[model samples]
Target: MSTSIEELLRFEEERPPDGEAERQGWLRPVLRILAGAVAIVAVALVALRTVGLQVSIPVLAAGALAVLGVRRVTAALSPPPPPAGGGRIGGGEEEGLYNWGARDALNAAVKRWETPLDWSASRPERFASTVLPRLAELADERLRQRHGTTRESDPARARELLGERLTAFLDNPPRRPPSPRDLAVIVAELEKI
Candidate 1:
């Protein structure tokens, strides 16, 4: 089943009540930091006992300072947690149907080709209107860039370079999309031009 863009954007998950997540407060983090600092000081004091009390005391102080510095740096670098409310997760503009992600936009464009191809098979005029002009313009541009002349400027030479199939395709787009092999041949001829 096809999914609507609105459905995809809406948050469907169940969330806790507001203020529940924040109620734990800063007490946990402060206690954790203190415990870590004490542990570091204890380890340093034990490790450097043979160096005498003077050196050991200084080492313990340095260890405590290093632990606190690292904790502070990590806290500063990390992003704040999302608010307790069931608000948007990302701290950016809300994405709408038109503001598609890169992959989604590409997929939508690619999928859209099938509709035109189906129309072309039933109505040649539709193909002529939608696809022929673009192809002709591309051919003209390529010819002009390579030979310093457009298809209209030198029709005879352009016809020879573009080949009969592409020339016919541009003159009149097919009722149905060309096969993969035919397309490859057309592309090869266009590259030669």
Candidate 2:
């Protein structure tokens, strides 16, 4: 009984009457401005009185009212909100169909890694500074997922699990980045972890 009552009250907010916004377009912003201005005046007057200051309340009110007016004007210039009936993305049926996943961000991440890797191939120090850290993180993540211990926590066991070549590669900063074939082999080993 209580669940049904709760569900009934959980309905979406009742939208404004159709054509009401068109008929009284200026009413909402005007009311907001009046309310903000009154609030500012009241606060300024009370604060001045409390501090025993004789600052002109009208001046304070005017400044605040101007700021509020600017805000309203800027908001009016900006893009309006989406349409009433749940917009395109908020369909009652399929959820993921309308949603645009972060395709650009995913592409950007690939480029971010690719750029560093490319740079490291020519400049060995770039491997230490940029690429090696990412590789180490991948290794640590795999180790943690498979063995429940990071390299820092169990270095001896981590070396055993990662094997001598891979462990040595990770332990010291390389004088030069590995060839693409070598890097592919290293990646395959990491995946096996």
Candidate 3:
């Protein structure tokens, strides 16, 4: 016999009925209901006495029994309590749903570029020393992967693939690095390879 992939991946949860919980403690509910009814009757009697009306003790006892009966009926009609293990803050993901402290979620490659890019923004030497070599390596890797040759290995085809502007930019590093917009354009062109 063969099982379908959907059937293999499907998850089913089976839980037994919770009728035992209601039967577990009969005394607690009776006492709690009795206490609540007594408190309610005491308050009602106090209110009636303050307003200059006298209610007999037997009438108050009857009223407490009525309250207890109503409470029992309502408890029977109300929904059962929820499953034992829910109502959590997170969506039950790994670790936690929130990062309470100072958490920076940057990709590894992008994070690696941050320091060099920051330094390069102020100084041409920093651009040459820090950021330029990484860009060159990335360009060369893409060229090699797609065309079987790096920029150094085949300058002619590299220049052809890299447009005139990109080729020129790579060949001669500017005294001052290009603006972020121009650098982004260069990176976009490199990605096309």
Candidate 4:
């Protein structure tokens, strides 16, 4: 019982709208407007206060906070740079292959290489291609160390090493650096490895 073209069009029009689409459509503009309003109000208040007007201290403090907030929000929206190196640090593709040139300093070198990359302010691609690999390797090593060398046998361990957050990031790389919280979480996980 297919409807006629006119009826179909009417039915389509009567259908409930997509809530997610509506929210997404308004999100960006709303944020921009809010940011603009904050900046404008802050500037205006600060300017008025500078002109010998008896502006309240609280007003000045609010303006300063607004300006700082706006700046931080804007900076957070900026893009990240590209990654370098073959994405490998100390533990290259051949983890078991590479022999430490020095004997006593091997642990030190591993420790140095294990140092987590700062994703809080690093490029997304750079984090994935460079920093992520090293962290993944660390996770892998930790897994290996814990339950013996069975990377193929241990799916759960591999997932843990990949990390829920890191897996999402790597699966769909961000256009900008990760948030400070995300970076910290990933770094902490890698350090544990």
Estimate, for each residue in 1-193, the C-alpha lDDT of model 1 and write its tens digit. 9999999999887876467556656667778777877887777777667575545566576779786978786665564453466245443344532222323433555578766575334665665676667678889999888878777898888888788888888876666766657767777777777
Q: Which 10 successive residues of model 4 have the least lDDT summed?
A: 97-106
What pairs collide in candidate 3?
Answer: none
Give the clash total for candidate 1. Answer: 0
> Residue 187 in model 3: shift from native, Å?
0.7
lDDT agreement with native, every candidate: 0.70, 0.80, 0.77, 0.62
lDDT of 3 by residue, 89-165 (tens): 55443656633332333434467667555755578788888778888898899888888888889999999988898
Sort by lDDT, best first: 2, 3, 1, 4
Q: What is the lDDT of residue 106 in candidate 3?
A: 40
- Model 2 scores a C-alpha lDDT of 0.80
The residue pairs in collision within model 2 are none
Model 1's TM-score against the true structure: 0.36
> What TM-score does candidate 3 get on C-alpha atoms?
0.40
Off by over 4 Å in 3: 1-117
- Against the true structure, candidate 4 reaches a TM-score of 0.29
Return the lDDT, model 3, position 145: 87
